[model samples]
Target chain A: MKAIVVERGENTPSLIETPVPEPADGEALVRTLRVGIDGTDFEVLNGNHGGFPAGDDHQIIGHEAVGVVEDPNGTGLENGQLVVPTVRRPPEGSNEYFERGEPDMAPPGTYLERGIDGAHGFMSEYFTSPEEYLVTIPDEFAETGILVEPMSNTVKALEHAFASRSMFDWSPETALVLGNGPLGLLTLAMLDQTVERSYCLGRRDRPDPTIDIIDELGATYVDSRETPVSEIADVHEPVDFVYEATGYAKHAFETVEALAPNGVGVLLGIPEDWTFDIDGGRLHREIVLENKVILGSVNSHLRHFESAKESLARVPDWFTDDIITDVFSPINAEQALSSGNNRIKTVIEFDTR
Target chain B: MKAIVVERGENTPSLIETPVPEPADGEALVRTLRVGIDGTDFEVLNGNHGGFPAGDDHQIIGHEAVGVVEDPNGTGLENGQLVVPTVRRPPEGSNEYFERGEPDMAPPGTYLERGIDGAHGFMSEYFTSPEEYLVTIPDEFAETGILVEPMSNTVKALEHAFASRSMFDWSPETALVLGNGPLGLLTLAMLDQTVERSYCLGRRDRPDPTIDIIDELGATYVDSRETPVSEIADVHEPVDFVYEATGYAKHAFETVEALAPNGVGVLLGIPEDWTFDIDGGRLHREIVLENKVILGSVNSHLRHFESAKESLARVPDWFTDDIITDVFSPINAEQALSSGNNRIKTVIEFDTR
Candidate 1:
């Protein structure tokens, strides 16, 4: 069997030979179908962040993927069934928090995320996961099922934001999402169904594929490079909800200025250190007087995974074609990983064995 | 009638003569019995902040007070009935937000807060308010009902913080409150009946009256000077709920570091210009990965006012007496406004004129 591997502190990933994995008790063997390459994957490949599995010099890194259950082992999942496995797993086999049904809130160092942290990932010929961690997908979603894992996080972030706003009759009329990456575009797709006025901001200029997707979803695309987030409210209305996925450190603070009274800012970005001065005194006052809530959310729960599939079920099949820009076979995995070809979503497909 | 007036740009409050106010349609004339002076009053006296009523050179500065309805005038109020007049009024006599029953969340410049911004306050001998703005109290609360206005804001702040945590079964077991002023003490008093473990952090050394109030509420009094909020979790367990009322800008950010996973930090204090560099990058990560929510709250709604009265009804009578340190007549009003006495709450009182 072959696997995608990134050496410790390496800037590139390559294919390598590896032994096939066996299913353990209550776990089923899965043959990989497709693995998506996201910004996190690029970050892992560059060794900017994410930890390799302990006692191993290289990490099999890819958290977003769709696979077929090859050996059900009577785990209830049928062979040839499409499924999306979750990325995060509890450390020490399991912890009190995850055992209590909340692995997303696990404390630092107590959770080992597949591919992104201290465990082997699904970017291989075959992998194994316990029944509880795998979310079954509809047969119609077999080709684009890899998006469920990434899109589930967007669902959870919005769920957390709205949960915070349940005290009032909170119908957010306007929304601003501060990114145009795959996650940001997916967020816009979800908001398009609910929010009346929506905007997606990014660094690139107009006439891009991301902008085309935004237009297709009836959302306005704003180039953040020309119009900064601080000035967004001046050009448009103050937003009730801001889905921040840009991973820019300073935009987290700037979003405070763009929030409406009693607004909710859901931050999803994880950026490197880039400090800037802020009128924190004024920001503090707005939070106090205006009843504004800013919450940060990462990862997702099993329910969120279900929500992602439901959301995708509503959109047209061709819309997935707009989101998933390129697909490649395992022999040409390097092009999928290294290409800067205006790709929104790229994936490496594996032959089911 | 005598009134407490703050001249524009002046740092002192003085007694001034004013004509008795007349109630308009759907309004009632009230004679103030007691006007509670909290930190906002001191801040107004210092000319640090506070806006005068439109076209008025001086601001009548008092927001929290207990009074007697002097003239019912067909507004459904019995003469001599005990009531507390709300401090804020709609800027246009009524706005859509106020009409929709959420005056607390009204847009700025569209609302005027009596005593603090753009309206005369209850520090006057005779004031008039619409019946809708007056919250009636039981005769037993006459002497101490003045605490309701300030305490309602605390209730609302807690309400906002908890609303954000409603997605999970977020019954916080341990809580931390920053500050020992009236607002902070009131917060501790409210949490005494709910949370299992509570600690109030303040700069005052032991044996202080504030510490005694915290002790009486079965909450630990932590000297913040000895153990700053940044080091709080290092000493005690990670806090699940943080009520910040210290008016220190940095403590607002420090509380973020001390929050437990999925914790809530509710901010209340309005501080002056105090800025410090923060590892915002790290804080953002905590919010994203740990699913933390930080919200700021200031004013309270009519329902919150009703809730405050109900909360006051549940407490022992002598407890309120312990909280209000001094009450002054008109002749000694300057002392009430200027005295650097270690008073928890100071008030101006009038014989039921």
Candidate 2:
């Protein structure tokens, strides 16, 4: 078997040969089909984010994967079933977060993400996972099921953001997505179905494909260089909802001002340590006086994965083709991890039917 | 009719003889009984917060009042009914926030808060209000109903906080109140009925009345000088719900770290402009990775006033006596406004039974 691994403090991933293992009780042996790469993958490669598996010099770094079940191992799944694995697993026996079936709510030390933290990933020729960690999708979605993992996170973030406004009759008219990356585009696509008007803010100019995708999705494209997020309400209109994916520390603060009264901002970005000056009083006063809500969301629960399957099922086929900008084989895994091209979503192809 | 009014930039309230107001159609003339004083009143007096009524040099300043209807100009209320008035009124006809019956969600410019901003307050011996703004209570509540106005803000804040967690099975076992002023003590008293363990943080040491009240309420009192808010999770257990009433700007950021996993912080304090340094990346990452929620709430709606009447009805009579420490006549309005004495709650008596 061959796997892609990132050694400690390395900026590039390497292909290595490893022995295939049999599935244990309550586990399924899966033949990897495809794995998606995003910002988190780049962070893992740089060794600035995610933890290495205990006592290991390197970690297999892929969390968004779609695989075919080779062995159900007495679980509910069947042989040759199409499945997508969820990322986080409990550190040990049941704690509160997992016992209640909400590993998404688990804090830092209580859980580990496969391929990203304290656990090996599925970017390999063969992988084994507990049957409970796998979600089955229709066989027709073999090309797009790999997106179920990232889409699940979007599902959870949007769900929580809407839930926060459940107390009031919150009908948002406009929405702003603070990034134009793959996740941001996916979020924009999802919002496009409901919000009357939507805008996608990014650094890309007219030459980029993401800007065109934004236009194609029926959303206005606002370049960050031309109008900063804080000035969006002045240049454009105050948004009723803001989906933050840039992980730029300042966007978190500016999101406060960008929102209209009774609006909510859902944050999904994770950034590195950086200190800066801020008008703490003005921000505090704005939120308190305007009835604003800012919520932080990361990872997803099984329910969200199920919901993501339904959401992905609704996405048009042309979108899947337009967003997946790069696909590489194991020999070019490093290039797949560090592509400098204007890419939206990059993936590693592990096996064919 | 006599009223207590604060001129712009004045730190002291003055007792002035104003003309008695008459009730118009859809309006009610009320004889004010008792009016409570809190931090917002102080802010208005100092001219650092709140706005003056249009074209007015001074603003009458009391929003927390219990009164008797002297003249019901034909909406619903009968003469001599005991009532408490809500604070906010829409600027003009039909805004989205008011049309949906949610004046609390109105932004700063959309509405005016009586006594605090852009409207004459209830501090006068005689006041006029639209019938819809009055919430009737039991006659027995006249002595304690003055607390209803401030308590309504608490009801709204807590309601929004709980609503934010409605997406999950959020059964919080621990709670922390970040200030020990009247609002904080009132909040602690409210949480005492549900949360198993509660703590109130303040700057007071031994012999302070608030500390005694906190202890009497069966909640631990934490001195801010000893254990900073950011260290609460280390010295004590991380709080699952944080009620922030301290206007100190830094507590807003410290609150991010003070929360437990899947915790929520509802901010009610309004601070002044102050620039400070903060690790923005750390705060952003902490919120995202921990599934924390921070919501800002101010003012209260009509429904919140109705709910607060029920909450105040359940409070023990002894608490009303213990909380209201000082009562002064209109001749001593300045003394009532600037009592240097140690006090929990103060009131200005405008009429006797």
Which candidate should be chosen as best, given DockQ against the real structure?
2
lDDT of 1 by residue, B1-353 (tens): 89888888787887899899878999999988899988888888886554777788898888998889999878989998999987778876688778876777775667888888878888988889999999998887888899999889888888888878876667799999998888888888888777899999988766778888888888888887788898888888889999999778888788888898889999888776655677778778777877888898878778899999987876666568778998889778788887655788888888754
Model 1: per-residue Cα lDDT over A236-292, one tens digit each: 878999999988877887888889887899998987655567777877887777778
Docking quality level of the chain pair in candidate 1? medium
Per-residue lDDT, model 2, residue A324, is 90
Give candidate 1 regions above 4 Å deviation: A7-11, A48-50, A54-57, B7-11, B46-50, B55-57, B273-275, B315-318
Poorly placed runs, candidate 2 (over 4 Å) = A7-11, A48-58, B7-11, B48-58
DockQ, per model, reads 0.62, 0.81
- Clash list (residue pairs), candidate 1: A164-B164, A287-B296
Query: Candidates' TM-scores?
Result: 0.94, 0.96
- Candidate 2, residues B108-139, lDDT tens digits: the string is 77888899878989999989999989999999
What is the per-residue lDDT of model 2 for residues A112-147, given as tens digits with 9 covering 90 to 100? 889988899999998999988999999987878888
Q: Candidate 2: lDDT over CA atoms?
A: 0.89
Q: Identify the leading candidate in terms of TM-score.
A: 2
